[model samples]
Target: MTEPVRRRGRPPRAQQDAGPGMRERILDVAREEFAERGYDKASVRGIAKAAGVDPALVHHYFGTKEQVFAASIEMVLAPALEAPAALVDGPLDGAGERMTRFFFGVWDAPATRAPLLAIVRSALNNEVAAGVFRGLVASQLLARIAQRLDLPEGEAELRASLAAAQLVGTAMLRYVIKVEPLASADLEWVIARIAPVVQVHLTGP
Candidate 1:
């Protein structure tokens, strides 16, 4: 009998270590792709190719664009995401100060800003990211804040949204877009000014 065709050579080295690393590779590629192209124009295939993995792997790690977007922003979201409900339930006095503290606390961290800056830039220019950003605020920040308070129907949604618009704008000018005085001013100065507005939205008329 004709010798059986020689079996294919050993799997490529890239494939050799691919099993557990696919998730990390996908994240690395997705972060770069999202930063460069933004969410609207980014393709799973392109990201997967850049990462040297299959497009299906991207889906396997992150089910949808929304999930990928959220995952990417995980660092930036932590402070607000964790603080909303807790602060709202915490001591009522000095709520504005507490809120301000939390905002600066997150932004002040060097580790948080890099990923945050990427997400901020993406959200501004990318349509998909804009929607995902809105969704994150709605579900994670706004919803949580609203649930803890005695706000009227739909007020939490509105209030949280309004708070987001303000915070996002401030972040853009101060950190991401890096506009004039806002960017240069001391952190405390900026937070002091914005926190009241946020406090009003979160706590009062």
Candidate 2:
């Protein structure tokens, strides 16, 4: 042996020109891919190949396909952080009703509805997406609202969850499912009818 080849740490040729926002690009591509293909059939390698980056980068940013699904979801779902407080605070006498109306109003605009419907459809069809959906709804909307209401013995969670089912189901039928009158109706008209029901869900014993 004349000499031992020494390997020094250096950038690999594959990773040399990885562009900025590469991870985000992969996620964006993956989101569409997952939406189109659903979770089971969507492939990480295919997403990376389309994204023009190494597969490692995908794992680096998102860890796994499941994690990628979670990342994809953050784009769609709005966490109900400020809304609950805004709904409860002393702006109006019918706090519960106002809260309900405000909550529904959040998804009324296209900006809110677009990502939401995409994610909902994906989750409805895929278990991985469903888990992600469940997690986001629980953490952001349900738990926070429960805390705000000062619910006792976790009863508030059931109340909030039932309310969520109603609201989510309505969104599904009207927006995603595109069921007749509910979908065709004007926004305020829809809000007027739904607000009281949601108010009862919030304040009911």
- RMSD after CA superposition, every candidate: 4.9, 4.4
Clashing pairs in 2: none
| Pairs that clash in candidate 1 | none
Sequence-dependent TM-score of model 1? 0.77
Cα RMSD of predicted structure 2: 4.4
Count of clashing pairs, candidate 1 = 0
lDDT of 2 at 46: 77
Full-model lDDT for every candidate = 0.72, 0.71
lDDT of candidate 2 over 1-205, digit per residue (tens): 6855433432244564576766667778987887677777888787877877767667766777888888877755544444665666653337556765765676677666766666787788888779988997788767766665556747878877777777778877888888999988987888778777776776765
Alpha-carbon TM-score of each model against the true structure: 0.77, 0.81
Assess the local accuracy of residue 40 in candidate 1 as a C-alpha lDDT between 0 and 100. Answer: 74
Q: In each prediction, how many residue pairs overlap at the backbone (N, C-alpha, C within less than 3 A)? A: 0, 0
Which residues of candidate 1, in runs, are more than 4 Å off? 1-21, 63-67, 75-79
State how far residue 131 of model 2 sits from its true place (Å).
Answer: 1.0
Residue 104's C-alpha lDDT in candidate 1?
68
- Residue 186 of model 1, lDDT score: 88
